[model samples]
Target: MSRNGQAFERYQKINDLFNRRKGEMAVVTTEEILQKFEISERQWRTDKQKLEELGAKFEYDGRLRGWRYIEPFNFSDNIPLTLEDMYNLRLAVATLAQLNHIADFKDLPQTVNKIRKAVGRWVDHEAQHKAIYFDPLPQYEGSRHLPFFLDAIEKEQQVQFDYFSFQAHQPQNYRFDPYFLRQHHQRWYVGGWSHDPNEGFIRTFPLERIEGEPIRTGKYIDFACKPKGFNPITYWQHVIGINRPARGLVEAVVLRFNRVQGKYFESQPFFQPYTILERTEDKLVVQMDLMIEIELIRKIASYGHEVLVLAPATLVEVMRSFFAKAAEQYTPR
Candidate 1:
């Protein structure tokens, strides 16, 4: 094969190795390539740089003691997904459908299926695992908030809305400092400051809860005033959910996992760098920070009796009151 053909094949194998052991250790050495592909070390380095120019990036970290790869780094870097890559994606999609997924689509299913079948059969649990990571969230069916928010975002203006909160029986007018339109699960949320007289500061409001036309400010304020170098996820690292992300310092959130359902809580945490508080033989006490979006926490709790709100007394009480009222329906009604 020509030099370019040989380099491309080597890149494919490298990508496959990294993808297979995602989040695990992967090593690349001159010896391995020379033995496996009958190529020299000089040739490999040249090809590695070529791949980097093609938008592939990997970093050498002395702490992990190995190189870390960022995959599919470019969808437009002159590198098309290979036939094998397409097959893997297709296989994943099929397996996800089997997992009681009630996914809906408008028109691309038939064509996507045809393309997938033309690739190849995916192996065993590989497809299933890939599916779990690759699924897309459902889109909003009727989103009226976008136009209003878009106008305000573009104009750098403030907005006021008639808001109806879940616990509040009556609607209230709220002027806000809208910063972001965050989408969690399948719903859209606005995170900003509320101009309430008593507790006048920032808060979050779901788009669906807004009752009337939004009043926009004709003024401008710099968004750079907030922490300029921050990831919302990392910034709110201890947040129990995304409904309300802690503005600055993280708060500790302790949760109790229900007996039968606690295992689900053990699956993937909302954030890393968290400590597992206490694990009795029967139940698990999982504690993290309370900087996550509140809506995210509620959605996780909606999994029925799997998880319980333990601390912050306020959140626990909120859940307690909600479930108490819900339980009343079963009391010989």
Candidate 2:
């Protein structure tokens, strides 16, 4: 290992020691550290000094006979990164650069350039080689409003905008208390509490459907109206995709996929609450606890003949109807 690699390894070891002692009254003595690393006392002192320089503060406890952190710190934040770490970061920056075409990520290319310059000193010229490439994402509208919605959510403010739903002949004005922004299937959707007369519940609005920029209402969020203990992060825990049906209840959705398609589900699951009930040479049966929603239907239909809905009579009937309609489109007239 190089000098930088050795330094990173030693810092990682020290970090592990501190993490093990976290939330406990126990302390790790300098002798113990030195013995573990097989380093001299002088070298250990130097290491401690370097760590302190990197925002880690430690003091020797006379009564405890060991060193204790004076403040919360993460050694990795300031320590030299290994070559592999630098390479991986470079790859990530490259990947981020590909998203520059998106309005919300327009600054990514500049940020990637900044990172390349910062790491130029440690990395070789070969780092500039485009060794990996990502498929270009299709340009989708409505990403430009991401920053505005993010700001509104952060400030706990209400916003007003004009939205044109597919069913509506004209755009309709709406007042909403922005809660969170979610990206699904390359499109952006903002989930929030709607203040419209007919829709007074939490709902999501697709950004592309929004006619123009949303203006802040100059009013703070109505905390009283928000459901108690409702977390935006876990709001869709039982639902698939972004939409949560108005009266949908969580159900056990069982599916059987052919061996080939089963491998795909096994390697890359689509839902969080996923479990494999049975596996055979010809088929794979999996169950997911989720709400019956449009996204779930779309996902199941996407697998076509490769997958079969095995449980939840309602879902099975829904799938049958969906396939029947789809098959009718291809039927000879």
Candidate 3:
């Protein structure tokens, strides 16, 4: 009754009724609605008309055994935000209004309106918020797997897929007990346990290599469920890639990031799981004790003198052999 708008009292009653019924058909009994709002049955009709004007359709469905929201409702449009919420909304938009999505947030006009209303900011006539892109669209079919895999995580289920590991270069059957989904370097990946836990006696399957029809094996294994104990940051900690054994020999991987590159990395890189043990006089040191990726050698090669692969003789030799070939091509008379 003390809520902030003319229709606020009605708003609370309808939202409460829908929630109380736990998302079933939301039809409220007319008598209960009147008692809840402390209004007469005639006044209830007036309020219902007001709700209908705001894009809510409430129909009496005898079959549903209660009132239903019909098909859709636009709660964001009808509920106005407080002024404080406006600035908060702007900050959130500034931080996250990037990255391309399939359905196109551009087409989510309702979402746009909600943001505009929530911020109470200028919706038009000039520069407001715009989408930015740094990463290109993933050129494969599983680019859209982020959302679907997220659902599988919430449902605590297993999934089957036709997978292609970059190492293997061909697709194979994979049943994964998904642990978590993570983002690193603009790529989406599902991290999980598999009933086929050992790929070749020690490694696990990578989900990106997974392709084609993903069978939704919703049957959950309570004992094998891993999300409860899996900490993504520490799990990937000191981990070079998915193929490495979870527990093996830890190495001190040393590399430098100059002032500019250090900040660039801080802004973007998913560096967790890799412990940074030192910062030297002229550079920042990143150390991760994980299996060496032959590709990581090339990444260090591109950094040139800016990064040094100090210690770990095995990795240094690997980098040496790779760059030695490049140095051969640069011989000049």
Best by lDDT: 2
**TM-score per candidate, in order?**
0.50, 0.78, 0.56
Give the alpha carbon lDDT tens digit for every residue of 1-333 in model 2.
Answer: 878678768977887787667543678898899899999999888888888778887777788789877666777566555578787887887778767899878778788888777778544664555577777788888988989999998989999999999999999999899888998877889998888879778899999999977899876557787767879888888987888977658899999999999999989889876888999999999999899998899999999999999999999999999999999999999
Output the lDDT of residue 282, model 3. Answer: 54
> What digit string (tens of lDDT, one per residue) describes model 1 on residues 1-333?
766566677777766554454564565545655686677778777767876777777776566555556664542335556666666676566654442322233334665555555553543444456544445644453256766786686676878888887899998987676766776555667765565666554456778788867788665454644445644455334544444433455556677776555666668655456577887767888777655344545655576677776677766777777778878989993
Count of backbone clashes for each model?
A: 17, 0, 8
Q: Against the correct fold, how does model 1 do in TM-score?
A: 0.50
RMSD of each: 11.8, 6.1, 9.4
Which residue pairs in candidate 2 have backbone atoms (N, alpha carbon, C) closer than 3 angstroms, thus clashing? none
List residue ranges in candidate 2 displaced over 4 A. 1-47, 52-78, 121-129
lDDT of 3 by residue, 43-90 (tens): 878777877787777777677545656655655567766666665665
Estimate candidate 1's RMSD in Å: 11.8
| True-vs-predicted CA distance for residue 168, candidate 1, Å | 5.5
